[model samples]
Target: MWQKVIIPFSVSFILIGCSEPEPLVEPSTVYQCAALTLTATVTDTGLDIQLPDQSYALVETISASGARYRDDDFAIEFWSKGNEATLIINGEPFPLCIEEGTLPTSFSARGNEPFWLASLTGQTLTMREPGSEQELTVEAPRLVEDEPIMTWSIAAEDGLNLMILDQYCQDSMSGQSYPYTAYLGREGEKEAGCAGDPRQLLEGVTWQLAQTASEQAPTIQFIPESNVAGFAGCNRYRGTYQLTGEGLQFNPLAATKMLCDETAMAVEDEWFRQLTEVQSFRLDAAGELDLVLADGNVIQLQRKN
Candidate 1:
């Protein structure tokens, strides 16, 4: 009887609840407005901005048209419509902020004096001049080392040949920098121009050590097809690289057998070690390439102009 009465006693219970996690923010967008470049990262409720001089965080605000963001102090404001944006600093508007477009993966070149354009897509190579355009099916370009410069030679039908140098060039009129200097040869005539694969920032441009101090700083140049060649203080090295979703990785590097003093060899050894340990790479606002290592150290490099 006592057991039956105790069984009628009240019981207590506890309840738990859970909420969904917020989604991650999308990748940042780079915008080139006139002479200024800006990188904007959209957050859950606001924007993280990176200017050449400084960085700013702004909250979303009401706008008549397009999206607008402003800081609490009203020191900076960003207004965007489609791919265009206007940046306001201290109430002074900087308009015409056009978004930077990605360049095509196909190789392209252009010259100004005589107005010529050439492009290689797949097996077809197209050449265009003032009033003439020609397309020819050609084989892939062959690498030819011309001493200090690396050149890619393309042989086409009808005795047409095109040579592209892995060197930096600037347009005479527009003053735009190109990764490669190109020469188009047909019959006995040749035309010189600037060529590039604009999508590849590390390609063609020579990069020199920016942070480390040395009389002969280490240098690197990324070639097409995942090949990389560099001067590592004492000897020249060549290796392959892979660009994955996570980061950049280099295969086992091979260097020329050249002996030098202890100082140079030491520098070379350190550089090779760093290159092997690189986990990722990024370009800073100042257009310097930063190679992040697994040990949380950074190897900075600048474009050799």
Candidate 2:
């Protein structure tokens, strides 16, 4: 009897002592996904994030209680009933629209500026610019609004339109306003201020074929104010032009069908395709011709010097 009791009691004591206690920790915190992010994730799982290049992503809540315990995972931004964060996309001046959600969309990656999010609200508000006036004023919405508000301007360049950020314009009388669109040969516009007709600007400017799909060389030339001609790979190419209120019509271009890899013509072909809008052109004080697109991309053109 004594032997059995001693053995069982010893075994029980050893087993109880072998178990370890739970470790201490702190609760978790979540952060919004970055605009330039390759991936979307919430820090703690409460707020959502809209990617700079991609659309918005939603975050799922973590079901946990007490402090010092959390499970981490990668996720996109999403909105829910309790979620309340005010996000002003590019300072449109419109009220923030909060709803169940739009839909999963791809990223335009046009232009995204720096901003911060504090809280969420359903009311929609637009950041509006008081129209232009003749006389200058000290206090006005254009001038009074803080930075991060007046972020971008629109202008045009060679065969391309630019939506420029970091570049600015002021009403002068009041302050600055958001210039969303542009019209050529009109007020508040640049005629490329080069030599002769718009076509003369491309004169002597050697635009090489950076990309091609065929063996035939394209008939590349500047059609003064109307078109850009040449061979796009194998497609015999002829592009018609329009300005101001008109649209650019690519007249069913033709090209040669030959095998080729990445070339200069190919690269330029792609660049031209992406240029849907031209915002502005400026011969900066540095004597550089800067081309800004409607999508807010700036390309500097040097005079082959």
Candidate 3:
């Protein structure tokens, strides 16, 4: 009898020892599908973030854990969980809009005294100091706010964060204040100053296909301003282009109606698809131009000038 009782007790203790405890982390949330692009803007008195589908203005809320951008008088926090993100300003909360789009990699703005210059590549943010070659390269900015003036916060190597400010302006006629959007890093907002127009460097030169989805030696010519014409394998095509941020949006292309060999037509189809899908571009160290698409496809072209 004692043997049976001790055996049962030993089995129970063994089972209990083998059991595991529950995790201490909070349950993960499933967020609704939305865009990932975040556009930050500072208005006269508050902040406005343009999301993929809608816009959210800043409002009051309790504090939450996330990235923080702080100044002497104000603070902004950015929280990202799963597929969603929120912006908090001075204890206030606001929904952050996100979209599936490419962010601008480089931009420059000119204003009084300190010139506003910024470039984002991958996870890095580089801010060029005004009138000097010196620059502050840090992690991507986490918070952007307009307390009547525009401010940006980036995490630095040191404990202190780097802050960028854009002075506010009041319309004399209406008296409504607004941040200098032209001088700040506004999403989808493109001006002439940033990393000099990539087209300006590509213009006046013939580009021969170096690498593409189709193995065809197509050629292209980019006229100054908004005109671009190219030959895809056997067909000559023309289209207008609009540059926004670091991406190029192409108008409906006009191509000559002609019959070609099967290989050439296949190549042409691939070329047209590549052109339409192009969203951003970069000039590699080899001096080759790589036009990137939303799906991460790349059309590589080499200068034949």
TM-score of each: 0.38, 0.25, 0.38
Kindly list the per-residue Cα lDDT of model 2 for residues 126-226, writing each as its tens digit: 11123421211111111222255422222222222222222222222222121211112224443221011122223323233333343543334434335
What's each prediction's clash count? 0, 68, 7
Q: What ranking emerges by lDDT with the best candidate at the front? A: 1, 3, 2
Candidate that would win on lDDT: 1
Summarize candidate 1's per-residue lDDT along 156-207 as a digit string, tens digits.
8878887888666656665445657888887798878878643245653578
Q: Model 1: runs farther than 4 Å from truth?
A: 1-102, 105-199
C-alpha positional error of residue 10 in candidate 2 after TM-score superposition, expressed in Å:
99
lDDT of 3 by residue, 142-237 (tens): 446656554555454533244444433322322222222333333434232222233434454568788644456888777654678888887898
Off by over 4 Å in 2: 1-220, 231-236, 245-254, 262-269, 277-290, 299-305
Task: Supply the TM-score for candidate 1.
Answer: 0.38
Q: Give lDDT for model 2.
A: 0.31
Model 3 pairs whose backbones collide:
35-98, 35-99, 36-98, 36-99, 36-100, 37-99, 51-97
**Candidate 2 minimal-lDDT segment of 10 residues:** 103-112
- The ten-residue window of minimal lDDT in model 1 covers 96-105
Score each candidate by Cα lDDT: 0.76, 0.31, 0.52
Candidate 2 local lDDT, residue 65: 33
| Model 2 residue 110 lDDT score | 18
